[model samples]
Target: MTFSVPSPDAIPRPDPSGADAEFWSALRDGELRFERCAACGTLRHPPRPVCAHCGSRATEWVTSAGSGEVWSFTVIHAPTLPAFIDQVPYGAVVVRLDEGVFVVSNLLDCPVDELTVGDRVELVPTRVDDELTLPLFRRA
Candidate 1:
């Protein structure tokens, strides 16, 4: 499945840096990655500088298979943000990656009424422009 997104100019671009730098870089290069604590091998999302399970500052970037299930989701029938006004009725989802960490991103391609818990999805690295990219999902 596939869907159209707002123009790159209309959508806000990400400012990738710090712990987020690698993740965004990987996405731009067409890969999905997560932060894993080097000391304990614990995986985490929203890439952090320190491990939550262990107080380790050392971490590694692990590429994902980009396979997951829809853990939860919601449809924005009426967007409150002006930038997304024309994109009303989009899906916001929490995808539980096969590696165990959950990622919050938009669920694309599938219709709101058809979206359901446990729905299988896969990564679709979306490039917004020369400087940015997004890790969007689509039903597999």
Candidate 2:
């Protein structure tokens, strides 16, 4: 399967704030960054200010291995936005990273029906624009 890079104007951009700003910036540099709690050694996604496990305010950004397994997924047959109309039947996967955090991203370069729950996947950073690049996944 071949995926076309979307035009910057055709795709939605992230509006990063606080920790999110740092996360987005790292992606632009071709790195996948996630939050790790200093107090409890827990990893979390969506870049929270506090750790959910230990309620620790001490957190730091860590570069991920960018490899994971597909825990769950669905093929989007309907366009949720007009910009995605040309991208229907894409696999939206919930990948569980080896570090134990999960991220929701698109699974590319494979047929949707061929994806499985335990399928190994690796990050493929795709530039959405000059300032924003997304961490997409492909079969490992």
**Maximum-lDDT candidate:** 2
TM of each candidate vs. truth: 0.91, 0.92
In candidate 1, how many Å is residue 29 off? Answer: 0.4
Model 2 weakest lDDT span, ten residues long: 1-10
Off by over 4 Å in 2: 1-3
Query: Candidate 1 — which pairs collide?
Result: none
Per-candidate clashes, comma-separated: 0, 0
lDDT of 1 by residue, 1-140 (tens): 22456687787767877878888888889999999999999999888879999999999999999999999988777736666777666778899999998988887768777889999999999888977888889889
User: Model 2: per-residue lDDT, tens digit, 39-76?
Assistant: 99898888888999999999988899999999998877
lDDT, candidates in the order shown: 0.84, 0.85
Write down the TM-score for model 1: 0.91
Q: Could you tell me the lDDT of residue 116 within candidate 1?
A: 92
